[model samples]
Target: GIQVEQSPPDLILQEGANSTLRCNFSDSVNNLQWFHQNPWGQLINLFYIPSGTKQNGRLSATTVATERYSLLYISSSQTTDSGVYFCAVGRSSNTGKLIFGQGTTLQVKP
Candidate 1:
């Protein structure tokens, strides 16, 4: 079994600010993903970085398997970015069952 934890617990920022969220896992995982749970409770996949770096617009993520950790970066934050960010990992590469972290709640004020 694998366990995940997210840091900062909570965050607050103004528009245009930048922030970094962290995720630490207890064991080796074959798959990892970053997700944003919107106010409506919809989980939006942000990244699928299992052992590398990836960027999409104002968001980016990096995972280090050796360190058993991952990071999510948000640049020029906006109110629209406010949500609960989650880090999920799967023990088996092909398994869709994932264990999620406690999540980091971000609040961006306009």
Candidate 2:
């Protein structure tokens, strides 16, 4: 079993600001994914960074499997970025079931 934790339980950012979200896991994992749940409760996949770093426009993520942690960086935050960010991990033995951690909720004010 693995445990996950996210920092900055609550965040407030002005529109166009930048923010960094962090996730820490207690054990080794084979799959790691980042998700953003909108105000309407729709979940969108942000990145599947089990290791190394990846960037998609204004969003980027990095995972260090050895250190058991991952990070999501949001550049130029927008009102659209206001939502709950979640980190999910799946073990190799598990059949694609992701264990999610408590999320970090971001509020971007215009």
Candidate 3:
């Protein structure tokens, strides 16, 4: 079993501003996932980083498996970026049981 926690439970930002969100896990994991829950309540997968760094346009993520933590970086964030970011981890892909972090809520104003 693993525990997950996200920091800065809430965030407010002006359009174009940058932010960094953090996620920590209690134990080692075989895979980690980052998701963005949009305003419409759609959970969109952002990254699946078991370790190392990954990027998707203005967003990037890095996972340090040894430290049991991960970070999501948002650059030049837009209003569309406003959403709840989640971190999930699981022992293995086969288990399909992921532990989710509380989530970081981001609000970007125009």
Estimated TM-score per prediction?
A: 0.97, 0.96, 0.97
Model 3 alpha-carbon drift over 4 Å, by segment? none
Instruction: Write candidate 3's Cα lDDT for 24-104 as tens digits.
Output: 999999989999999999999999998999999999999999999999999999999999999999999664998899999
Candidate 2 on 1-110: residue-level lDDT in tens?
78999998999999999999999999899899999999999999999888999999999999999999999999999999999999999886353889999999999999
Each candidate's number of clashing pairs is: 0, 0, 0
RMSD of 3: 0.9
Better of 1 and 2 by TM-score: 1
Candidate 1 stretches with Cα past 4 Å from truth are: none
Error of 3 at 102 (Å): 0.7
**Per-residue accuracy of model 1 over 5-109 as CA lDDT, tens digit each:** 999999999999999999999999989999999999999999888899999999999999999999999999999999999999998888589999999999999
Q: Which pairs of residues collide in model 3? A: none
lDDT (C-alpha, whole model) for all candidates: 0.95, 0.94, 0.95
